[model samples]
Target: CSSTRKVPSTEGKVAFNFIQINDVYEIAPLEGGKTGGMARVAYISKKLKSENPNSFLVMAGDFLSPSVYNSLKVEGQRVRGKQMVEAMNAAGTDIAIFGNHEFDIAENELQQRINEASFTWVSSNAFHKKGNSQQAFAKTDRPVSEPLPPYFFRDIKSVDGMQVRVGFFGIVLPFNKANYVIYTDPLETAERLYNTIKDSCDLVVAITHQSMEDDIRLAERLPNLALIMGGHEHDMRKQLVGNVWILKAHANARTVFITNVVYDRGSKKIEVMPKLLEVSEKIPSDSLTQVVVDKWNRISSENFASIGFDASAIVLEKGEPLDGRESEVRSRSTNLTRLVVKAMEWAAPEADLAIVNSGSIRVDDILTAPVTQYDFLRTLPFGGGLVEVEMKGALLRRILTSGEENRGIGGFLQYSEKISGNRDKGWDINGLPIQDSVSYRVVLTDFLLTGGEANLNYLTETNPLIT
Candidate 1:
């Protein structure tokens, strides 16, 4: 707010800056307090708003679930995403799109969060399945068409009073879930919305939470879109496809993308320049917003403390950064998963091996030095007691083979050090071939015992001994 962002003096040109982030889970700084606090983001917002006469703060998706803070009990109930909306409101967010995780919780809870937000919200193909007419859920102020308005528009005038139209639309991954909501074809919906506004708007921008492949396909199909601010993947990426530019930042508010749009009135030309901002100590905290963040942080810490876990205290000095990112851990080996499977083994020391679903490991971040109680909770937010079972070698082989078949899924197995396998090929235990007729003891979560996986349902059916 104090100083203006210096820009080259380009005559007959005016600028607009777009500030964007996605997949934020933590309200406070992560990595042992080294990166990503909402107060810093709030400060940057104020600075960006002052620097550019026209600007927008946007989030693509996945702010509603898979969080350690959500695991905290507030008044003896799940505080799922109540903290996120409060912090985003303090940060002064302008708009947001619905990500797949938004549907992870109950439908009523999501509607409650929507009503709680102070910013405008938009969506693509997100509609209520019932009510006879397939009513759209997102209540937009400026209604465009059926199934909820697909886009929002605003206009700004240059120094000479020439009006410029800026239009925005949003689309997300087509994660189909029955009964409550529906996700129509993403590319088709985006194309239709762009066609409707292309005639009137000078620049059309998109807010999306889809794969880069879909982003590229959408850009190629609709060449009129100026930029696609994307999410879903934690990796930061920037690419130009046809006439459209695509951008994404790291997840958990660790990174952000700021796009400066310069429009020249004389040449009727537009140029887009994007910069990646790493949320670090360089950005000062806005004390007003920091107050709200601290309130939630303090409450969360105390909640964890009551359960014999000091959320902020150091637990272990990690030798290397444990890769627990969603995309990576769900598909491959990670120290966090290994540590978790080992813990399961400790509880059932008599078992031959320990195994659990990758989806069960939801902390979704790298564990650096001085790992804290919060870090462990983040890794296993949905806490449950471990269970042990006895099964024939044939059943064990079948269970592992099924897990390998569904590779890269959250439910994929992450087993203990004693067990190894390629889901598609075969499995081995303790450096020896499994005897078909012999029975082996194994440890796993009760969820798995109660039919969490397709083949795993047999565990409960047989009613094996709970060691």
Candidate 2:
């Protein structure tokens, strides 16, 4: 009997592929009646998975926040959080991370959504609060007061006979003591996890909601990290540092990320290819996911259909920059910036000058009516209130200097019509040769007044901006 020896396919090598999508804040249909809804993401995700059986899908945090339906109720009083979980489940997400806004809901509610999630929920820096003696808002999985795990791992089989192991870790910005119960630092936390699991897994991916600098630093330090998918800054691109590939998708589900990596056994090296997928008309919406999204849309409309006027635009579309320092509404500057400035002026009259952080101006489009209170709320939905800070010329200069140095997209300080800086060329803002040491009273949001993330050289003077 001649026995034919077959070549053993069990070489110590494997080929694998996976997809990552970030900053998909809104799963439902946007107000403008455009797509990029959960259904569309679901459609794309299903197609990708079908094409590559070993394919796994992951969301790099910011899946929920600034959403009209999500903000309507707290403590699970309304079921929007549950609905989002349902949509995520239908979309076939294998894992998801957390962004800062996930805390928009209380601890209990956040846990409920996590428990309801069909896939794994992770936030490397997210901490759970222990329940009060009374156990108010307590649930079975989480005590009223306790921190949660920062990472999760899954074993997925590849098309070939190779088994691939993937590890996912998440991290959000640390909440200030006033707001957070237990805060976890992203860098420290990531290091701890990486040290623990570096050898156990074939690949480690970090889901972060941090600034670009923060992500870059992490990639530099973590040599074993395969991918760094993040948000928070809402930058739309893929960057590589060493062997680690860093990616962040635009907010509000406007775009998603698709990353590919090939593992070669001969070289014992893995090559990464990252692509940004703009959520556009080309991709069809998944029918199964659409059913869940439609419900959220109807619910959002019912609750938030009464805040702004129906206008041509809710956000300023991409175009030319506005006049240097003039605060004309007609300027094609950011609509959200214009509105926030208007709101501050209306709310705080005493302050002669008004300014807001570019980051605070989150809404990408202008608000048109049939607009929900939810729309306006989501526009600047961070619970931060309006504040009038006392500042003189010197302080104003310091704030400006700080803003200018900031590398973040929304770090620039937007001023109102009353104040005009060299008001014509972008050069004035981009080219401040020296610090101006003049004193001027300025209006700033509570976020800036507190000197949160960005460093503003300004010192406080007197009046507090209204809440």
Candidate 3:
């Protein structure tokens, strides 16, 4: 017999794929149904998983609250994240991490959503708090299959018989700490987790909700990481710090990241190929997911109709591409802001002027299609109506000036038609000369009459137009 030995058939590489989405809140298509529906997202996931059996779907976090749907109530209980959990379950999300917005709702509600989810969720640094904790909430109808483990481990054996192991952990950035939970340093927590799971796994993956800068710091501290996935930044980002790789996607499901991992058993090398996919009309919708989405759309419309606004009714078409994104609304005068203030002015036509905080307007994108009543609710979700209050021109000037000076604040002032002048010019009330003692009927939200959210202080209301 020949002395030459036959090479082992199992010396090939194993491939693992990951589908990542972060900061997605809207389950339905945004922008007049042009893009970004959870149905399409589900379709993409199913296609990817079909292509590669070793694929995993993930959301780095922030899907629970902050939508008009989240404000709905069923029998006096908040539907805070009931819809979100259902949609994500249909979307095939295998795992997720907590983003800062996850804390925007009450802790009990947060617990309720977490308890309802079917996927595995982990937050390495988050800890249950003492006193008035989330334990008071009722258990979800379908409890999670397992408690959220700080780290998740998975082993893969390729068709050719090559073996690979991936260990995953999730970390969240600093958040509002609203009597819910405390957090440990992400790097420290990561180090502890790595120590416990390192020897058993071939590679480490970090699914983080921290800033890219913090992720870089984490990379420097823990050099053994193979991949890092991030959220909280609203745009796509990718960077390689040393040998560690970091990847992120755009907010609102407008963009996603798909990473393919190849591990070579012979050379002990790992190759990562990443693709940035746009969530657009090209992606087809899964029938089951589309059905769920349609149901939610009907529910959302009915809920808003109960509040006396026909959510499906088209109000305005495109005059121009209106900027409604949070950054623009919170920071500057945008076309969307101008249009919304115009509506406020129209709503209170009898008043001399109308004023609102920029923060009160919330849909975060440029509208290039039909505007509906649901879009209005997305802009102003807190349910405050217009109130006409009489105040001295001096107090009006003070409120406007206060709002102007405090630019970049959510409560920053945005005025209705014909109201001009700035804090620097002493703000001409109604674009007219101000008389210190003269009374003017100013239309604004009742929230402002109680407190100048932008620091208006109300300055005392003498005459009231209660209608």
Q: Rate the local accuracy (lDDT) of all candidates.
A: 0.77, 0.62, 0.76
Instruction: Let me know the TM-score candidate 3 reaches against the reference structure.
Output: 0.77
Which consecutive 10 residues in model 2 have the weakest lDDT in total? Answer: 1-10
Error of 2 at 393 (Å): 3.7
TM-score of 2: 0.76
Candidate 1 local lDDT, 1-467, one digit each (tens): 01123333347776788889998878877766678888888888878887665677888898878788777888886778988888889888888888877777776777667777887778866766665567667533235432335687767665555666778888888663635787788988998888888887777889999878899998899876779999877678799987678999888878889998877767767788999999987778888779888998888899988888898788887588877887787677788778888788888889999878886776667888778878888888656778777788877887777677656655678887877766454677888776657888988887688674544556564554332
- Candidate 1 residue 405 Cα shift, in angstroms, is 7.4
**lDDT accuracy of residue 272 in candidate 3:** 81
TM-score of each: 0.83, 0.76, 0.77
Residues 1-467 of candidate 3: C-alpha lDDT, one tens digit per residue = 00111122234777778899988778887787677778888898989788776788899987885677777876678878678788899888888888867877887788888887878787788766757453222234555434467887877766655567788899987654656677888889988998888897888899999877899998888877888999876668898888788898877788788998887777877788889998888888988888878888888777777878798787777566778876577667788888777887788878887878875665656676577777877777656688887777777777777887767656677776567777676656445777767887778877677663645554445323221
lDDT of 2 at 282: 69
Would you list the rank order by TM-score, best first? 1, 3, 2
On lDDT, the candidate that comes out on top is 1
Q: What does the lDDT read for residue 202 in candidate 3?
A: 84
